[model samples]
Target chain A: MNPLAEIVAITAVCVLSGCLGSLLGLGGGTFVVPILTLAFGLDMRLAIGASVISVVAGSAAASPRYLDEGFANLRVAVALEVATVSGAIAGALLAGHLSTRALYTVFGVVLAVSAVQMLRHRQDRDGLAVPDDPIADALSLHGTGTGTTVRDIRPYRVTRTATGLTMMTAAGAISGLLGIGSGAMKVPAMDLAMRLPIKVSTATSNLMIGVTGAASAVVYLQRGDVVPLLAGAVALGTVVGARIGSRLLAVVPAGALRVIFLVVLLIVSVQMLLRGLA
Target chain B: MKAAPGAPEAGARQVALVLRIGGGLGAALVLAGLAVSFAESGGGWLHGSGVDPLGGDATMRLSDLIGGLRHGRAGAIVLLGAIVLAATPAAGVVTAGYTWLRARRAWLAGVAVVVLLLLVLAATLGATE
Candidate 1:
């Protein structure tokens, strides 16, 4: 692909990815990474660097609405960052020693797992039950459970706090290692492990991803994996796409979209795994 | 119980505000760089070898990038834009930390500071390499 054509192509695909990712409450990095490595023929390392830029771009763009609308929990976000940020740095350091093929293999596994999780789509109406965790109480992590879009805000007690942190650490490491936003891991850690409401977990994951991506982004930048023109185009496309996607989410019936996205992810995951093997 | 406006929610709003301004500025600069690049290169964007994202030859020091901008190099400007975009979230994190402080949440403030330090450390590490 012509270098400029590559930028233009990635930008176009990223716009669609950003739009759909935001609409589904999945950060855009998943789509961004595959497109760069597969379509643009960028090395896995360079692709990760560019993908993180788009993830941060989309987060910065859509976060205002998610936060202001009461979908995200700030206390939880801050609490989790201590684990995620540290893990991201660790993952980044490890990336230096790991070979290109090793990174690709890991990326394939992550994509496959994320695809299955997305298809599952946790039941929405599970009653909120707040657990008795002293750490959560000390940190004031127990949220008031006032929702903006989901209207039925139930303040739930946290459970398995330590496990949640452990999962978050892994998520952060995967994020830094793969150059993804790590929402796939973070969301489950918060939603299933910690028992946060799905809405809060998803939105908070969006907020956390930007910070996680930014942290490891410095590592990529230092290593010169970030191509400015390519990254800039991806960033531009993502921000624009996220803006449009967020607006559409209000009206769209997400059930159908979720099904469509599941099939797409499965195919992409398989392709990535094969590429890694090859 | 009907929910009242909370301090954390308010702090999040402020952080969101910072992100909007910082990200918008960064995106605008990048787009501007693209326009300039198109004009200077005269439709050669598609003809050059694919982007060398991890190549040493493509990497330049921050100082050199600034100097390149003076010479009207679009790539330099684009790089500046990227650097700004990368930092914008850290700025927001600091802002959030400050907000947590004002709200008298010391632990959250501490968390913010720690994350801020990590970001600085990461960037410093990048510069060294």
Candidate 2:
């Protein structure tokens, strides 16, 4: 492929990936990696590296909009990040030693289970219940979501801080090992376990993914897996795509968002299972 | 309990500002690098066999980056941009933690500090390995 054509193709692909990523509060890497490697015939390591960078770029670009719209819970993000970062470190260290096939199977099963739980807990009313976790209470993890109008403002209390944090560690570890955002894991944990609204879960997940992606990104950088021209094209695409996605998120109804999340979840779950089995 | 009026908004605005700066600069540098590469290559930027310009390892060091910059290597400029982009989230975290501290949200601030430390530890461990 010609240089201009290749760059344009990558940017275009990443634009769609970034849009979906921001909309789903994912890092956009899950889509970017396979597309870059399979379609463009790029190196796997370089694709992962560029995908990681795209994740960071998408997260950073979309988060401000989420924050402005009051969907991203800062307190929640800060609290859970500790576990995610720790898990990422451990996962990075454990990377080469473990069989990725086994890891994929485990992650796939986890995603399937979480998808079921998320479906079972589709009722968003749980957000209004008094949270039982003292840690969450003390940290002020509860917040009001400003979805569309004054009527759309829903105040929510966070529950099961321990469970959520535990899941976050797993999410981060997966992120480190796979060089993906692990938002599929995170959204379920937050929505089902922590009882956050789906929008809140998605937005908060967006806020934390950049930090999580960064944990492993530096290693990729030092390893020289990151090719500048490709990564640059990807980063540019994500910035634009994430901007468009964030704007859309502000108006998308919570029910629609939940449905979108679940569909994406099942697709990712199936993909993971297929990879593991293959 | 309701948050102080505009406190969250204020902090959010500040963090958003930082994000905009970082993302904007990173994107700009990337664009500039691509343009420079195209110009330098005289529009046949994809030429040459046995070397994938968009793939392979380009292990960069501080001094190497400096030298590359002096010689107008587009790869160096783009790499620098990517590094800056990678660092942006950490900077955003610091800003968030600082804002929390300023608001006297001690627990939130503490959590932020721990998260930051863990990130640094991950990088350090990754480097060692």
Return the top candidate by TM-score.
1
Model 1: per-residue Cα lDDT over A222-261, one tens digit each: 7767767777888899999988876665456657887888
Show the lowest summed lDDT stretch of 10 residues, model 2 chain B.
B1-10
Clashes (backbone N, CA, C under 3 Å), per candidate, total 4, 0
lDDT of 2 by residue, A18-87 (tens): 8878988877886777677657877656776788788888888998877776778888988999988888
Q: Flag clash pairs in model 1.
A: A4-B45, A130-A156, A130-A157, A131-A157
Can you give the DockQ of every candidate in the order shown? 0.45, 0.45
- The 10 consecutive residues of candidate 2 chain A with the worst lDDT sum are A146-155
Chain A alone, TM-score for each of the models?
Answer: 0.91, 0.85
Please report, in order, the local distance difference test score of every candidate based on alpha carbons.
0.76, 0.77
Cα displacement (Å) at residue B67, model 1? 3.4
Tens digits of lDDT, candidate 1, B73-128 = 88788778877877888888888889889989898888889888888877776676
